[model samples]
Target: MLMLLWNVLKKFDLLSLDNEEEIISHLRRLSDDENYLLRDIIQAYQILQDCFQNITYQHLQLVKTVVEYSNVIEMMKKSDLYSTYGRRRFQELRDNLTTQFQLQE
Candidate 1:
């Protein structure tokens, strides 16, 4: 669903073609997940796209932030130590840092 929306947006020049593959790649793994989280992430992406339109500098940074954080989260979830409280704390810190970067622009 997210990929289709992204492709539609890209085809219509509403989104960048350069980042289209990267966005789809980032989203491909969760394509089959029967959960709402992926949809929420795409919604967040769209929100950022709308809210930060015309701010290319910040927009790229936003995409990078989300992709990197999502990758980390995915790795943590698949790792043996993911259930540990310390990993959760680390994720919280990482999220805070990402938020700080987003807030800066």
Candidate 2:
């Protein structure tokens, strides 16, 4: 049950929320509804892999990679790494990461 709640929090992007009352309020708001989204973390991972082109998203190895690359993307956004060259490099890196995640047929 606790894991289920954790998955919901992660899926809803509410994990960073530290206010207990607010968290309870949100839980109450979602009570008995949208049960479809309350999945375990692995299922969420599979959903991510399915939605993307080639991301294999291995259960054992993905957490750090995602966190690190995601930070890079966020930082780059604030840094206006959106210049033509930077954007191209970022895309190339993105595509390369996709290839790295691809599953062999």
Candidate 3:
């Protein structure tokens, strides 16, 4: 599964896409796993697309922050060490990814 993900990411040139529909189509073809590692990547890409709609920057620190944050979140998604509280926090983060905390309590 991890290998499949790596292969997809190696060829995933989402930034060059000109339309959201094309991106969604590509994501749909990625994999059928519901909560796989791709979920975090999918949501992160969408949120970044929406939030940074007009920003154009070639900053190194920001790029590092995005990559590091995504890597840690992806690891957390597959980690089994989350206790009850930790699981809840993880869920909250997941929810925020899609809803941006607007619909979360």
Count residue pairs with overlapping backbones in model 1.
0
Tens-place lDDT digits, model 2, residues 1-105: 433443434543543345545544544445445564545435545433333334334732454344446667588788666698888887888898888889543
For candidate 3, the TM-score is 0.23
lDDT tens digits, residues 1-105, model 1?
555544434434454566756555554544545564867678647743663476577755665465547667567676644567768787888899999999999
- Which portions of model 1 show Cα errors greater than 4 Å? 1-4, 36-105
lDDT of 3 by residue, 44-92 (tens): 4674455346555654345445554776756776774377877887787
Per-candidate TM-score against the hidden true structure: 0.27, 0.26, 0.23
Model 1 Cα displacement at 78 (Å)? 49
Which candidate gets the maximum lDDT versus the true structure?
Answer: 1
- The regions of model 2 sitting more than 4 angstroms off are 1-74, 77-80, 103-105
TM-score of 2: 0.26
Flag clash pairs in model 1. none
- As a whole number from 0 to 100, the lDDT of residue 68 in candidate 3 is 49
Q: Rate the local accuracy (lDDT) of all candidates.
A: 0.59, 0.52, 0.54
Ranking by TM-score: 1, 2, 3
